[model samples]
Structures are given as C-alpha cells and as structure tokens.
Target: MTLDTWTTRLSRSLLVNGLPREYVCRTTREMADHLEDMRDSEGDDDASRRLGDPDTLAQMLTHGFRRQSLFGRHPFLTFWLSPIPIATFLAHIVYLFTIELIMPVVVRLYGESEVAFVSGSLDATKVVLVLAMHLWLQAIPVLLTMRLYRIIASRAARPWTSIIPAMILFLLYFSMTKFELTWPSGTNPGNYRIDIGTVSGFSSQPVTQGLQALFVALVCILWLYRVAGEQSSERESAVTAIP
Candidate 1:
C-alpha cells in the first residue's frame, strides 16, 4: 500500500503488459509524485485510495501506451520464419566469400623466402577463423530465436502463438543447416560449403547439434515460466495488499 511498493508493482505490471521501459519508468515516477501530493494533503499512506490498485492502473496505462506494430503483431512471420534465418545464412556465405578473396592477397604479401612461414601462418589463421565462424554461425540463430521468444513472452497476450511455431522453425534450422570450411591446399583456394540436408552417411554431429539446440530451448522455456510465476506472485500480493 506504500507509494514505493505500489509503484514497483505498477512497473512490473506495465512491463508484463508490454509497455516499453521508458514509458513505464516515466509513468511510475509521475504516479509516485501524484501519490506523494495526495498523501501530503490527505495524510494517508495507502496509495490504492489515491490511484486505485496498481494492477488496474497498469491495465489502463497499458491500454493507452501499448501499440502493436506489424512486427509486434506478427512476430512469428516477421522475425521467426523468413528474414532473420535467411539473412543470417546469406551473411555467412558473404563472410566465407570475403575470406576467400582476402587469402590470396595475404599470401602474396609474403616474399618467396617466407613461403613456408606464410603457408604455416595462413593455415593456422584459417583453422582459427573456421572454428570461430562455426561457433558464430550456430550461436547467432539460437540467440536471435531466444531473443524473439523473450520479446513475445513479455509483450504478447498469448506468447505461445509466436513461440511454438518459431521454436519449430528454429529446431528445423538447427538440425538441417550445416557449414564446412576447407583449408587451402597447394593450388586450391580455400573453399566452403553450406548444406541444409542430411549428411550422406550416418553422423553424430547433427544429433549432437540438435541436442544442444533443444537444451537451450528448454532452458529458455523454464526461465520464462519462472519469470511468469514470479510476476503472478507479485500481482497476487499487490492485490491482497489493497484495502
């Protein structure tokens, strides 16, 4: 019932209701000020009497401030399905192509006397870069997918509408997508291949990658559920505190 307690509850509710952080902070500060003024004039510590319940106030504020854009309304279609994954794949291709173009220039920079040294250095560098790129390629999609899921969970009335379909798409991408970088040999410029299907032979790599992706997805889901539970507890306590 205290001003700080009321404002804290209101802030959480506003965020859960999809109001932006800036808007929520501004509103909470303004409301706290108003509550202080009311307390000074009326000599009452109970904020519910001045501003109504925080949950109800948050609902009203959210109605005014929460505006859904095309992306917000259709997060699955805009974020999860097409552009992000496709764009990431294209970016990976572009990155590999750039490395291919640069390797020759790098090799040329060394003198004939340093040919052995240059080749060894280039091979080492290629190995490091390939490993880095592989990790990057795998991590980016998972990070992006989880980020989108978090946004939807925080803002959407029914987050699963976007989350379920997105999860499915991401799992498919994780299982099917593969990248291979071949280091340069004597005459062959280093080459890279991107594949999106089953490997020719039975391999454990896809299964391992799929399990990793599933673990990440599972962790995110559990975390979101915990957050939701905490928010519900806060809301319930706020309601009970109201006279």
Candidate 2:
C-alpha cells in the first residue's frame, strides 16, 4: 500500500479504538512523516514489511494510549463516554432547531417589540446571553449523562472515578467549534452579527459551556467527598462504640 493509504488506515484504527484526539493526531503525524521519508529513501518493500500490519500498529499505539489516559483504571467508563462527541453533535442540532423554529413562533406571540427583537440584529450583550443560554440547554443532557455514569461507576470504584471521563468529554465538547459538526453549512449558534458595533463574532458559548460543566463537576465531587467522609465517620464511631 502507498504511504498515505497506510497512514490513513493506521489513523482510523487508533481513533476508533478511543485514543484521545490530540495524542492520536500528534502521534499519527509524526509516524506518517517518518514512514513517508523512509519510503522515499529505502523504497516501499522494506518499509511495508518492517511496519507490519496497520492494524497491529494501531493496537500497539492504543495499548500504550490506555496506560496514559486519565481514566486508565476504568476502561468501561472511558468506553462509556466514547460516543459523547456524537452526542454533542446531535444535541447541538436539536438546539439549532429549537432556536430557529420554535423560538420564532414563541416570540411572535409575545408582542411586536419582542417579535422585532427576534427578527432584528441582536446587540453583543444579547447575542452573548442568547448563545450562553442556548449552550447551557444543550449541555444539560450531557451533564445528566455524566452524573448517571458516575452513579453507575460508583459500584466499581469511587464516584469521582467517573469524573475524569466526564471532564474529558466535557472538555472535548466545549473545545469544538461549529466546524466540528457544521463546518460548511448550517446556522452557527454564535456566529451572528452583533448590532452594537456591527461586529460579527463567534460567541463565548464554549467558555459558558465549560463553566457549566465545571460547576456540575465541582458540585458532584464535593458532594461525594462529603458523603464519603460522613460515612467513614459513622463507621468509625460505630466500631468504637461496639468495643
């Protein structure tokens, strides 16, 4: 196979097996460059044989990947949040629909002033608020999913064990732009023009979403810690009284 073809297969396999995107991209880029140069000087036959199977290469990369993960101890939890990027895409689509369709109808019924606000160019402040609010709504389901996963994972380990996966997913979700899901088309949630300064800008929705996720995580972690501490105290007191 050509260097490009081999690299493509290796990249796909590593990504499919749940290597973090940053690590996968960086590692694959270096591997591809090295292989391409090797093929250039040494020819295809030796490089192909030495590299062995692309599948095996991906497995070796991913086996080492697991060792480096924040949630390395809980493979199931890491696997559990594997689909979160897809979920983020789906949720954003839903958010877009609600803002585009239902919101217009609701504003129309309110009054002419509100109707104008809906149709007219929004100022920076309003656009910021709108985007932040919409993103929060989109993030609600994700937060619930995280919490539920933590509850389920508590049986296997401490509840906080689930937070790393949830936090990683949250970071990925918040880091992405409209490009991830709607690069060339579709209405971007925050990519509207603000009337205040005639400024067209991407909204601070990502930061808002990050803050929301962090808040939820903090609350859950502290709550779990407090409960565990209380339970530990109770167990110690009971043991002492029995003695």
> lDDT by residue for model 1 over 1-243, one digit each (tens)?
888788888887776665655566678878878887888888887898768999998877765543455445565576456644654565466446645664456445544233443344346665565455555555555555556565655564333334555556655555455555557788776655445434431254656456545654665566557656865775555444432
Candidate 2 residues 202-223, lDDT tens each? Answer: 2544553355446545644565
How much is the lDDT of residue 114 in candidate 2? 52
Highest TM-score against the true fold, candidate: 1
For each candidate, the alpha-carbon lDDT, in order, equals 0.59, 0.53
The alpha-carbon lDDT assigned to residue 78 of candidate 2 equals 56
Segments of candidate 1 deviating more than 4 angstroms: 16-18, 42-45, 75-132, 141-168, 179-192, 196-243
Q: Report residue 58 deviation for candidate 2 (angstroms).
A: 37
